[model samples]
Target: MVEKDGIVRVGLDAGMNALVRPAMYDAWHDIVNLQRIDAPADGQFDVVGPICESSDLFGKRRRLPRDTAPGDVMLLADTGAYGHAMASRYNLRELPPEDVIDGPVA
Candidate 1:
């Protein structure tokens, strides 16, 4: 995991021969526990999404803070690099909206 300025970068794979992080040794990521902000974690877990697919997982047995749950915003750290760059509009699903965190405004 490499750091440029202050932001962390995370890589995610969609199975199908795709690999995230360790495979490429690109960026560093942190598994944030969006559920419980003040509690301790019992164990690690594989954070998944509701996309209904085998490769729709975010992290695998990652150690988080605690109390993560549905409707909570769990951030996949350091995903700004190849995350949006490799987005596809498959299954008629709309691409996620993008927000500009920095840089000059147009």
Candidate 2:
């Protein structure tokens, strides 16, 4: 996480490596901080990745919990196949494992 020019930026571990639609098509993905689901959204943040490129940003001016911090579990909603199908090891980043459930998850 970083704060510069009064703008908060949160770096995510899951980047173009797992979802490239954001960087490739400038797509908008609903970013949710699972840990702060019930917390008030008092912070504006730019959700980014560790990739060394300006296009690695996933979201901008995102409203999230004011105390969003490292180790927080985040979810990029509505990715579908466009995001996952285009994932690549462009930065030599290893592909993360994915879980598929057979039925509705509790």
Candidate 3:
């Protein structure tokens, strides 16, 4: 994560290899800070991945918490249907791991 001029940029652990919807379709995914889900959005962000390509962006002008920082876990909402299914080996990046959350537990 990096911040400049009140714009936070978040680099994903997995790049286009894990999700291609955004880069390929200009898709918009809701990014939520798991630790501060209810906090007000203090700034906009360019959520991207670690790939070298310019199309590796996940979102632009995404609003998130002001204190969001590196190592913070975030959720790209509504991605279960297309995120992993569209993954590729581009840039030699590995696919993201899955974590199953059972029931209504948070």
Q: What global local distance difference test value does model 3 have?
A: 0.81
Superposed on all Cα atoms, model 2 deviates from the true structure by an RMSD in Å of 2.5
Candidate 2 lDDT: 0.85
RMSD in Å for model 1? 10.3
Off by over 4 Å in 2: 100-106
Q: What is the TM-score of each predicted model, taking all chains together? A: 0.56, 0.88, 0.84
Could you give candidate 1's per-residue lDDT for residues 23-91 as a string of tens digits? 344334565655565667664665544454655555655675434454554555556657666666656
Q: How accurate is candidate 1 locally (lDDT)?
A: 0.49
**Residue 8: error of model 3 in Å?**
3.3
lDDT tens per residue, model 2, 1-106: 9988988899988777788887778888899999999999899999998885888889999999989999998888878766668888977998766654355757
Poorest lDDT segment (10 consecutive residues) of candidate 3 = 97-106
Clashing pairs in 1: 8-78, 9-78, 10-78, 35-67, 36-67
**Best by the TM-score measure:** 2
- How many steric overlaps are in each model, in order? 5, 0, 0
What do the candidate models score in CA lDDT, each in turn? 0.49, 0.85, 0.81
Let me know the TM-score candidate 1 reaches against the reference structure: 0.56
Worst 10 residues of 1 by lDDT: 8-17
What lDDT does candidate 2 reach at residue 72? 99
